[model samples]
Target: MMVLLISTSIMFSCKEKANVLKESIEADIIIYGGTSAAISAAVEAKRSGKSVIVVSPDKHLGGLTSGGLGWTDTGDKSVIGGLAREFYHRVYKYYNTDEAWQWQPKEEYGNTGQGTPAMDGENRTMWIFEPHVAEKVFEDLVKEDSIRVDRDEWLDRENGVVLEGGNIKSFSTLSGKTYSGKIFLDATYEGDLMAAAGVSYHVGREGKDVYGEEWNGVQTGVLHHKHWFESDISPYVVPGDPSSGLLPRVSAENPGEKHSGDDKIQAYCFRMCMTDHEPNRVPFPKPDGYDPMQYELMARVFDTGRKDWFQKFDAIPNHKTDTNNHGPFSSDNIGMNYDYPEASYERRKEIIKEHEQYQKGLLWFVANDPRVPKDIQLKMQKWGLAKDEFTDNGNWPHQIYVREARRMVGEFVMTENELLKKRKTPNPIGLGSYTMDSHNVQRYIKPDGFVQNEGDIGVETNGPYTISYGSLVPKKNECKNLLVPVCVSSSHIAFGSIRMEPVFMILGQSAAAAAVLAINENTTVQNVDYNKLKEVLVAKGQIVE
Candidate 1:
């Protein structure tokens, strides 16, 4: 929360020792993220014998892998080679020993999206795992690589540093640390470093016309799942009443263009960590600013004898589950984070608090309310947070599942067609394959007083799609020495697939590998000889198919 102010009388240059007005540290490569990608890139840099340091905003790294997305969304497993594949193997090793499963039986936690033991052992590639386990794997990589890591240091983007010719001379952080490196990589989900480096990035969803993407903007009536109520859905603006007033949080304005897109982005939420064991369970506390009216749809669903209230808890290792929003008014904090991608830190903090309250309140209403269905209440009441996980933060996970965010408009913008396997790029740097999934953008009331959700759409993009190198690097003129891995240049639908934790790791490694090559050769990141880069990547097991 404290920003170290920079002083006057600073003296420095790229080669000379910089007594930074703020604070100073010099390295060959400086990475600005705690994500798996950041770790991968830093490791790659170290393996190449480069001096590197990671200044992560998070105390813990691994992004979603540590965040709560234990069920990995991998496309073609074979395409998930190199560091991405190593990460999964590490998870398997964690579960290899019997002691890893203290809560649940080993057989129960087996077959977690990996290949089965028998029946020809299905030729699998992608790997899924537990949240803490993923964090451990990331930590192991840091330890094995002997990489220098500094946590909780946010970048001072506005007046951090600038380039004289084209390369990034240096950058500053809020924690009185100025990082000067020959090459820099922005591996954060928010693309903060990229934004600070003056690279162009888009915050909201772009129209289909803007990117020629079929799946771009505000999708209103397009249903992607079978969670909607079977009976007549009310749109009466009020619960049970034909006309009382618009329900709390329901948008009054119409979001036009069902097929095309808009500037509004999809929602985000923390994947709640819940356990069924009573010894480890902590009852859901009613969050401050709790509003029952916001969860009226949930009540309606429960009143109709709905037994599918817990459909979102995709069971993870032990007896724990990675819980996300299953249907209407679940954990996906619908319509509340429309401005989070580009919001200021204060504004973003407020949004996070609001989301935390909404999610916490939702759980409380379900667990303690008399209005909830008996069977659903009984089941929900059994679950609480695990005792052994996230010990520092009351067992609740620290990272929020930032689904999507500010994407750089780099040298090349990956589009839906590429992700859908419709087109091929000559400069393919990595591969990603996952369904184009977006959470609800807004909640609206129908004419019949029932709720109508907007923006939740899942389109399956078949095959291991090609990801362009330009997706990671900005146009040579924008910032030659800078690279972005998490929020790389890509269309909304395309980014949905590329935004996975594994792919970020792959791209992170690739970005740093390219950076080291660029540093060794006096050329822009654009001019790193692909053959030489590919050699190092292949040696590292990175699949650039």
Candidate 2:
């Protein structure tokens, strides 16, 4: 490996002349994300005797795992194997020490998970944890494995990647640093590298006819979750007055027909880390653009005798809760993130800021607004941002949950048919058992002139299902050296199941194993020997059923 340094002069906003230094590093494998999957891939690559580097736009690792989704969306514990399970095992080890449980006693903390033990004694795994603890565990892995991670290095999506003969030769970041590798893994939620490399991908939901699947497209009538407005709440500012204009956040467009295709995606929100503990709680600050009228619909919903604002206040360790979007109008700023999938970096930052402002304002409204029910207001006031977590970023999560993004159209596509056990999957690399869950894509006026949210679907998989290896690699003609674990080749509905954090780590390990094999055999990633790859993965304790 060699590092080449290049120097250039650039002018900044202040018109100040500064020297821009660029470094080009060569490695056997290049992982272009700081997600949990990216860490796992780097660990696997190092174990296979390959030099690897993690070029991440994020300062922190573990994506949502280290972010605030600490509730753990994993379905079956048995399916989580290899490095993914090892990660949980590390969490268990962390908690075994007295220092890990700072807010509560270890014995007093009750064990609770998704129908599983929060602290699994038999398997030596811990499922539920705080956000900082998860980040620490991931950081420990990087340290122990000596994995090099370059933080806050954004990929130049428009003109960064260089492809030669259907393979990526090298890719440069906005920092002007270039990375050349024999194989690359796009483990990011946004699939920035894959998109910049000219790989085919899909952003929106496909019609049922295209995939021959029931849950692929716009779902108008299905009410899987309690996220929709229960009562016939008016969409207008004045009740039943169309000329009064639509209420804030409610879409003016008509919700399309059921099962029809549309270029819409599920809403995104920050899985807020909140605590009610007296010493650790930081009171919600009223955002800059806090608008009381924005939550007028929620206030009306409360008038209809509903007080379930704390329904999804899922508990984590140390009195912290991974508070999520709940009810008709809650943390989810619906329909505001449709342009985020393919938007520019600058535009994406604006969207993120808008989401943060909307969610923060919602919390502040619930805590202080007189329009809210007195009981709800008092309860919300008790909880605040955790003081011990995210200290660098105003006690809020640093990453926003990009629930779904650009999914690569690779050699194989995982669909609901495979998830529902109607069709057999091939070349099993990992197992995904989470429910096929997708949040509402749009909130629009119903034919009855009432506001309603659409596209929320939650259907449980029959059991743990195998994820194919082909889902990770692009088509042979498209890109030979790249593998995508986070944005795998799958239909929108099927991706809901595969998008879980543990499954992403599993696929990351599998992708790394395949890349190592391809590098050893001097073949394309598509041409890697599956039998040998499966053998190596299983030997490493991966669940490759």
Candidate 3:
């Protein structure tokens, strides 16, 4: 009987170790994001000497950081510090070796590098590379640390269980894998985990009235650029035939009258990676269900003798280009993404496929159509998809350019005052320097019977501005273990600047520091001492300024 009792005790002890109690596998911190911020946060959490786990919905990490926005949008490189600086330094390293410039001449590679400071030698940053290269860097982070990583483990927002009495007990994923951590970080771009935990969040553009933001919500009359000049332009489909109605994609409405805003997110598109070198290029394949009629408006713009249409795809290094929507009726599919923020998973898939088709079709239209000027077509012909990138996803990019979406409405809502370089918050965790940029949200048919665009607001950030710490914290009543880095609490206009990848990493490092500090104090992430947080951030070489 004594021997039997001892055996039972041993069995229970083994089982307990196998299934580490909520506090065992729970780690000191848990981050829900697959974006750059998420990875940086995880890396920082480990470096800060805390066990961490990354539960990401995305199969591939680095969001847009590794997606396609390869040309970093670095305003003042001096302000970049911590993991943000390290990321660029890695990019510099990727390009320093002669093997990196396989397609172009060593000298023609322009050692000067993408209009930024030299990122050469061991302390370099290979800032420009294929999406796969960026993913490799993120992979290196996990390999470097014995940190736990669960990919495609989407937080079961509703009914996933975030036990909160201002502290998270455990949150379950769709896989039924429950993660219990002392401190949680919602580093996701969508803030899904935070929202599911009953945290307050905003969808679409807040009206100018709510935030008193000049660039918030609907701006029907503000025309930033003229890529589609219907003044002398013909229609995209067929010119001068109202009986044929408008193009398939062109909306025939007068957008909206509100000055502030409604719940409409900005237009989204894929960032195509193109190589000018033919050997490296995979010519734009004719997308299935391709239609030339949809691009009739584009052809009409070309007919008007527009030369600046090609300027949108800004040139980058190694014979590559960072494509951006330049003028009116550019690459962005305006007004069509109104339901995306609250869209169901399947519906979001449909939206992404539609965007892919639109982008692919646009490339085909430009590549094969006779309407495109010969010289311009020739220039475009030199470029094609990077064959090495997005290998499993049919040469199409896995991550869509979700420029802005589902910003959290948390303890501190960063408004235009913060973005326009006006007010400073005491709980600042990071700084954003990008402009308040939002692409055209809606397209409308004018009274003149021509299409007009609205909602493309671009107000540059005057200087570096602090991102509030409250932005990361969920309401004290909601789950308190979480720290939001990507979808931090902010007005739509303000999030644009804070949306940069470098800024995300900076925020990620700061967020991890805060999360670990919370675990040590056995308090909510909100109650972390700001002075200590700043000290750790600065000591870690993070430019909190």
lDDT of 3 by residue, 1-545 (tens): 00101111122463463432221246668788899999999999898788888888999989997888876776666677888888777766766678777667556755443446344444455555557768888998888876678898877767876565766677887765677777888887777777777778888888888877777777877866553344644333455567766776667655677576677788888877776766667889898999887787777777777777677565556676667677665678776677776676678889888888888899888888999999888878888887667888876788888888788887789988877767767677777777777777776666666676777777877777878888878777776777888888888878877888888899899989998888788787778899999998989888876
Candidate 3 segments whose C-alpha is farther than 4 A from its true place: 1-25, 111-126, 226-243
Worst 10 residues of 1 by lDDT: 117-126
Instruction: Give the TM-scores of the predictions, in the order they appear.
Output: 0.91, 0.98, 0.91
Per-residue C-alpha lDDT of model 1 across residues 1-545, encoded as one tens digit per residue: 11234465556678886654555678889999999899989888998889999999999988878877877666556677777777777776667677777877776654555233311133333265567888888999999998889999988777887676877888877766788888899998888888887889887777778867777787766788753445555544554775576666667777676666566777788887788977767777787778787777677767766677788787776777788877765787777887887778789889988888888888999998788988788888888877877778777778878888899998889988777767776577778877787777777765555577877768888667778888889988888999899999987777777888778988998999899999899788887898898888888878888
In order of lDDT, best first, we have 2, 1, 3
The residue-level lDDT of candidate 2 at 227 comes to 95
Q: Cα miss at 330, model 1 (Å)?
A: 0.7
Q: After aligning candidate 3 to the native by TM-score, how far in Å is the CA of 533 from where it should be?
A: 0.5
Better of 1 and 2 by lDDT: 2
lDDT of the structure predicted as candidate 3: 0.76
Q: lDDT tens digits, residues 1-545, model 2?
A: 52545666564766566777778888999999999999999999998899899999999999999999998999998999999999999999998998988898888777787778888898899999999999998899889988889999999888889999999999999988999999999999999999999889999899999779999798987898899988888989999999999888988887777788888999999999999998998999999978989889888998898988999999888988988889888888899999998999999999999999989988998899888889889888999999999999999899999999899999999999999999999999999999999999999888888889998999999899999999999999999999999999999999999999999999999999999999999999999999999999999999988
Q: Tell me which of candidates 1 and 2 scores higher on TM-score.
A: 2
